[model samples]
Target: MTATPDIVPPTEVRMAEIVFPNHTNHMGTLFGGQALAWMDKAAFLAAARYSRRAVVTARSDQVDFKLPISVGQMVETVGRIVEVGRSSMKVEVELIAEDLHTGERKLCTRGHFVMIALDENHHPTAVPALPADIAGP
Candidate 1:
Protein backbone atom coordinates (compact mmCIF):
# COMPACT_ATOMS: atom_id res chain seq x y z
CA MET A 1 0.00 0.00 0.00
CA THR A 2 1.03 3.57 -0.62
CA ALA A 3 2.16 5.58 2.34
CA THR A 4 1.17 9.15 2.92
CA PRO A 5 2.98 11.93 4.68
CA ASP A 6 1.56 10.86 8.01
CA ILE A 7 3.13 7.42 7.94
CA VAL A 8 5.31 6.62 10.96
CA PRO A 9 8.48 4.60 11.02
CA PRO A 10 7.26 1.86 13.31
CA THR A 11 4.30 1.27 11.05
CA GLU A 12 6.47 0.54 8.06
CA VAL A 13 7.50 -3.07 8.65
CA ARG A 14 8.27 -5.57 11.40
CA MET A 15 8.94 -9.22 10.62
CA ALA A 16 9.56 -12.32 12.69
CA GLU A 17 11.11 -15.61 11.66
CA ILE A 18 11.89 -18.77 13.51
CA VAL A 19 15.51 -19.90 13.51
CA PHE A 20 15.01 -23.47 12.43
CA PRO A 21 17.76 -25.98 11.80
CA ASN A 22 17.72 -25.11 8.15
CA HIS A 23 18.49 -21.52 9.00
CA THR A 24 21.43 -22.50 11.16
CA ASN A 25 24.89 -23.65 10.27
CA HIS A 26 26.99 -26.58 11.43
CA MET A 27 28.10 -24.43 14.32
CA GLY A 28 24.43 -24.52 15.42
CA THR A 29 24.02 -20.78 15.20
CA LEU A 30 22.14 -18.69 12.73
CA PHE A 31 24.13 -18.04 9.58
CA GLY A 32 25.58 -14.58 9.04
CA GLY A 33 24.59 -14.47 5.38
CA GLN A 34 21.05 -15.43 6.26
CA ALA A 35 20.92 -12.70 8.86
CA LEU A 36 22.10 -10.16 6.33
CA ALA A 37 19.51 -11.34 3.84
CA TRP A 38 16.77 -10.98 6.39
CA MET A 39 17.95 -7.49 7.33
CA ASP A 40 18.03 -6.42 3.72
CA LYS A 41 14.57 -7.82 3.14
CA ALA A 42 13.27 -5.95 6.16
CA ALA A 43 14.75 -2.73 4.89
CA PHE A 44 13.39 -3.26 1.42
CA LEU A 45 9.92 -3.98 2.71
CA ALA A 46 9.95 -0.94 4.97
CA ALA A 47 11.04 1.34 2.15
CA ALA A 48 8.60 -0.13 -0.34
CA ARG A 49 5.70 0.01 2.07
CA TYR A 50 6.38 3.65 2.81
CA SER A 51 7.18 4.74 -0.72
CA ARG A 52 4.60 2.50 -2.43
CA ARG A 53 7.10 1.89 -5.14
CA ALA A 54 9.70 -0.65 -6.12
CA VAL A 55 12.84 -0.33 -4.08
CA VAL A 56 16.33 -1.78 -4.22
CA THR A 57 19.00 -2.23 -1.63
CA ALA A 58 21.69 0.36 -2.20
CA ARG A 59 24.09 -0.20 0.68
CA SER A 60 24.40 -1.64 4.17
CA ASP A 61 26.79 -0.35 6.81
CA GLN A 62 28.03 -1.05 10.29
CA VAL A 63 26.52 -4.48 10.66
CA ASP A 64 27.47 -5.88 14.04
CA PHE A 65 26.64 -9.38 15.18
CA LYS A 66 26.91 -8.83 18.88
CA LEU A 67 25.74 -12.31 19.88
CA PRO A 68 25.03 -15.68 18.37
CA ILE A 69 21.43 -16.55 17.61
CA SER A 70 20.71 -20.09 18.55
CA VAL A 71 18.44 -22.44 16.71
CA GLY A 72 14.85 -22.72 17.98
CA GLN A 73 14.91 -19.02 18.82
CA MET A 74 12.56 -16.44 17.44
CA VAL A 75 14.18 -13.77 15.32
CA GLU A 76 12.41 -10.46 15.10
CA THR A 77 13.52 -7.79 12.70
CA VAL A 78 12.22 -4.28 13.19
CA GLY A 79 12.83 -1.89 10.34
CA ARG A 80 12.32 1.84 10.36
CA ILE A 81 13.31 4.67 8.11
CA VAL A 82 15.95 6.85 9.76
CA GLU A 83 16.33 9.48 7.09
CA VAL A 84 15.06 10.46 3.68
CA GLY A 85 16.93 11.67 0.63
CA ARG A 86 15.72 12.57 -2.86
CA SER A 87 15.25 8.91 -3.79
CA SER A 88 17.07 7.07 -1.05
CA MET A 89 15.74 6.03 2.33
CA LYS A 90 18.11 5.24 5.15
CA VAL A 91 16.62 2.44 7.24
CA GLU A 92 17.76 0.96 10.50
CA VAL A 93 17.01 -2.73 10.92
CA GLU A 94 17.45 -4.29 14.33
CA LEU A 95 17.60 -8.04 14.94
CA ILE A 96 16.49 -9.45 18.25
CA ALA A 97 16.71 -13.13 19.09
CA GLU A 98 14.30 -14.31 21.76
CA ASP A 99 14.22 -17.61 23.56
CA LEU A 100 10.71 -18.97 23.51
CA HIS A 101 10.84 -21.02 26.72
CA THR A 102 13.10 -18.77 28.76
CA GLY A 103 11.77 -15.45 27.54
CA GLU A 104 15.31 -14.21 27.16
CA ARG A 105 16.03 -11.67 24.45
CA LYS A 106 19.36 -10.73 22.94
CA LEU A 107 20.43 -8.27 20.35
CA CYS A 108 21.95 -10.28 17.55
CA THR A 109 22.69 -7.75 14.85
CA ARG A 110 21.92 -4.18 13.87
CA GLY A 111 22.54 -2.54 10.55
CA HIS A 112 21.60 0.41 8.40
CA PHE A 113 20.38 -0.23 4.87
CA VAL A 114 19.87 2.37 2.23
CA MET A 115 17.09 1.65 -0.25
CA ILE A 116 16.37 3.60 -3.36
CA ALA A 117 12.82 3.95 -4.55
CA LEU A 118 12.27 3.31 -8.21
CA ASP A 119 9.67 4.48 -10.66
CA GLU A 120 7.91 2.27 -13.17
CA ASN A 121 10.77 2.90 -15.53
CA HIS A 122 13.16 1.73 -12.81
CA HIS A 123 14.55 5.21 -12.37
CA PRO A 124 15.10 6.80 -9.01
CA THR A 125 12.05 8.50 -7.56
CA ALA A 126 11.16 10.64 -4.62
CA VAL A 127 9.82 9.30 -1.36
CA PRO A 128 7.89 10.93 1.45
CA ALA A 129 9.79 12.30 4.39
CA LEU A 130 9.81 10.32 7.56
CA PRO A 131 7.81 11.74 10.44
CA ALA A 132 10.03 13.94 12.58
CA ASP A 133 8.90 12.38 15.84
CA ILE A 134 9.52 8.79 14.81
CA ALA A 135 12.73 7.44 16.27
CA GLY A 136 14.99 4.81 14.73
CA PRO A 137 15.42 1.45 16.36
Candidate 2:
Protein backbone atom coordinates (compact mmCIF):
# COMPACT_ATOMS: atom_id res chain seq x y z
CA MET A 1 0.00 0.00 0.00
CA THR A 2 1.10 3.53 -0.73
CA ALA A 3 1.85 5.84 2.18
CA THR A 4 -0.57 8.68 2.77
CA PRO A 5 0.66 12.22 2.51
CA ASP A 6 1.08 14.06 5.76
CA ILE A 7 -1.67 16.53 6.60
CA VAL A 8 -0.39 19.90 7.64
CA PRO A 9 -2.13 21.68 10.46
CA PRO A 10 -3.77 25.00 9.66
CA THR A 11 -1.82 28.12 10.50
CA GLU A 12 -2.94 30.20 13.45
CA VAL A 13 -4.78 33.44 12.67
CA ARG A 14 -3.70 36.76 14.13
CA MET A 15 -5.55 40.08 13.82
CA ALA A 16 -4.72 43.46 15.27
CA GLU A 17 -6.84 46.49 16.05
CA ILE A 18 -6.10 49.80 17.68
CA VAL A 19 -8.20 50.82 20.65
CA PHE A 20 -9.89 54.16 20.00
CA PRO A 21 -12.10 56.36 22.13
CA ASN A 22 -15.16 54.95 20.40
CA HIS A 23 -14.06 51.42 21.29
CA THR A 24 -13.64 52.18 24.97
CA ASN A 25 -16.02 52.61 27.86
CA HIS A 26 -16.47 55.54 30.22
CA MET A 27 -13.52 54.21 32.20
CA GLY A 28 -11.32 54.58 29.08
CA THR A 29 -10.77 50.88 28.77
CA LEU A 30 -11.80 48.47 26.05
CA PHE A 31 -15.40 47.39 26.34
CA GLY A 32 -16.12 43.79 27.23
CA GLY A 33 -18.60 43.38 24.39
CA GLN A 34 -16.13 44.77 21.88
CA ALA A 35 -13.45 42.40 23.11
CA LEU A 36 -15.79 39.45 22.75
CA ALA A 37 -16.75 40.53 19.26
CA TRP A 38 -13.12 40.67 18.20
CA MET A 39 -12.43 37.29 19.73
CA ASP A 40 -15.37 35.75 17.86
CA LYS A 41 -14.20 37.22 14.59
CA ALA A 42 -10.77 35.71 15.09
CA ALA A 43 -12.30 32.34 15.84
CA PHE A 44 -14.43 32.54 12.69
CA LEU A 45 -11.45 33.37 10.53
CA ALA A 46 -9.40 30.52 11.94
CA ALA A 47 -12.18 27.99 11.47
CA ALA A 48 -12.91 29.16 7.93
CA ARG A 49 -9.25 28.90 7.01
CA TYR A 50 -8.98 25.42 8.44
CA SER A 51 -12.08 24.05 6.75
CA ARG A 52 -12.04 26.17 3.60
CA ARG A 53 -15.79 26.54 4.04
CA ALA A 54 -18.27 28.89 5.56
CA VAL A 55 -18.42 28.69 9.33
CA VAL A 56 -20.53 30.04 12.15
CA THR A 57 -20.03 30.40 15.88
CA ALA A 58 -21.89 27.73 17.80
CA ARG A 59 -20.91 28.86 21.31
CA SER A 60 -18.31 30.65 23.40
CA ASP A 61 -17.01 29.34 26.71
CA GLN A 62 -14.52 30.14 29.45
CA VAL A 63 -14.18 33.79 28.52
CA ASP A 64 -12.08 35.67 31.01
CA PHE A 65 -11.11 39.32 31.14
CA LYS A 66 -7.73 39.43 32.79
CA LEU A 67 -6.66 43.05 32.27
CA PRO A 68 -7.85 46.43 31.16
CA ILE A 69 -6.78 47.74 27.77
CA SER A 70 -6.54 51.50 27.69
CA VAL A 71 -7.26 53.67 24.70
CA GLY A 72 -4.41 54.08 22.18
CA GLN A 73 -3.19 50.56 22.85
CA MET A 74 -2.84 48.01 20.10
CA VAL A 75 -4.91 44.87 20.53
CA GLU A 76 -3.76 41.67 18.90
CA THR A 77 -6.04 38.64 18.79
CA VAL A 78 -4.69 35.20 18.00
CA GLY A 79 -6.85 32.15 17.20
CA ARG A 80 -5.94 28.52 16.75
CA ILE A 81 -7.90 25.32 16.42
CA VAL A 82 -7.50 23.17 19.54
CA GLU A 83 -9.92 20.34 18.79
CA VAL A 84 -11.99 18.95 15.93
CA GLY A 85 -15.22 16.96 15.75
CA ARG A 86 -17.26 15.75 12.82
CA SER A 87 -18.48 19.20 11.89
CA SER A 88 -17.23 21.44 14.66
CA MET A 89 -13.90 22.96 15.65
CA LYS A 90 -12.90 24.36 19.01
CA VAL A 91 -10.86 27.53 18.67
CA GLU A 92 -8.84 29.09 21.46
CA VAL A 93 -8.44 32.85 21.20
CA GLU A 94 -6.33 35.32 23.14
CA LEU A 95 -6.47 39.08 23.07
CA ILE A 96 -3.29 40.93 23.98
CA ALA A 97 -2.91 44.61 24.61
CA GLU A 98 0.30 46.50 23.82
CA ASP A 99 1.34 50.03 24.68
CA LEU A 100 2.73 51.70 21.60
CA HIS A 101 5.03 54.02 23.47
CA THR A 102 6.27 51.69 26.18
CA GLY A 103 6.29 48.43 24.17
CA GLU A 104 4.62 46.63 27.04
CA ARG A 105 2.18 43.82 26.31
CA LYS A 106 -0.37 41.98 28.36
CA LEU A 107 -2.96 39.32 27.69
CA CYS A 108 -6.20 41.10 28.35
CA THR A 109 -8.70 38.40 27.51
CA ARG A 110 -8.96 34.74 26.54
CA GLY A 111 -11.78 32.46 25.42
CA HIS A 112 -12.79 29.30 23.63
CA PHE A 113 -15.20 29.28 20.68
CA VAL A 114 -16.90 26.47 18.88
CA MET A 115 -17.36 26.92 15.12
CA ILE A 116 -19.28 24.72 12.74
CA ALA A 117 -18.60 24.38 9.05
CA LEU A 118 -21.49 24.80 6.65
CA ASP A 119 -22.36 23.43 3.27
CA GLU A 120 -23.93 25.26 0.34
CA ASN A 121 -27.31 25.00 1.96
CA HIS A 122 -25.95 26.40 5.20
CA HIS A 123 -26.26 23.05 6.89
CA PRO A 124 -23.51 21.57 9.00
CA THR A 125 -20.82 19.75 7.04
CA ALA A 126 -17.99 17.46 7.91
CA VAL A 127 -14.54 18.93 8.37
CA PRO A 128 -11.15 17.43 7.84
CA ALA A 129 -9.61 15.55 10.71
CA LEU A 130 -6.56 16.82 12.52
CA PRO A 131 -3.29 15.19 11.59
CA ALA A 132 -2.07 12.40 13.82
CA ASP A 133 0.98 14.41 14.84
CA ILE A 134 -1.02 17.50 15.69
CA ALA A 135 -3.83 15.62 17.49
CA GLY A 136 -1.93 14.35 20.49
CA PRO A 137 -3.00 11.17 22.28
> On residues 80-127, what C-alpha lDDT tens digit does candidate 2 reach at each position?
998899999999999999999989999989999999999999999999
- The TM-scores of all predictions, comma-separated, are 0.89, 0.92
Worst 10 residues of 1 by lDDT: 3-12
**Candidate 2: lDDT of 112?**
97
Q: Name the top lDDT candidate.
A: 2
Q: Residue 20: error of model 2 in Å?
A: 0.1
Question: How far in Å is the alpha carbon of 56 misplaced in model 2?
Answer: 0.5
Candidate 1 segments exceeding 4 Å error: 1-11, 135-137
lDDT string, candidate 1, 30-83, tens digits: 999999999999999999988888999999989999999999999999898888
Supply candidate 2's per-residue lDDT for 127.
Answer: 95
Residue 131 Cα positional deviation in candidate 1, in Å, after optimal superposition = 1.9
Q: Which stretches of candidate 2 lie over 4 Å from their true place?
A: 1-9
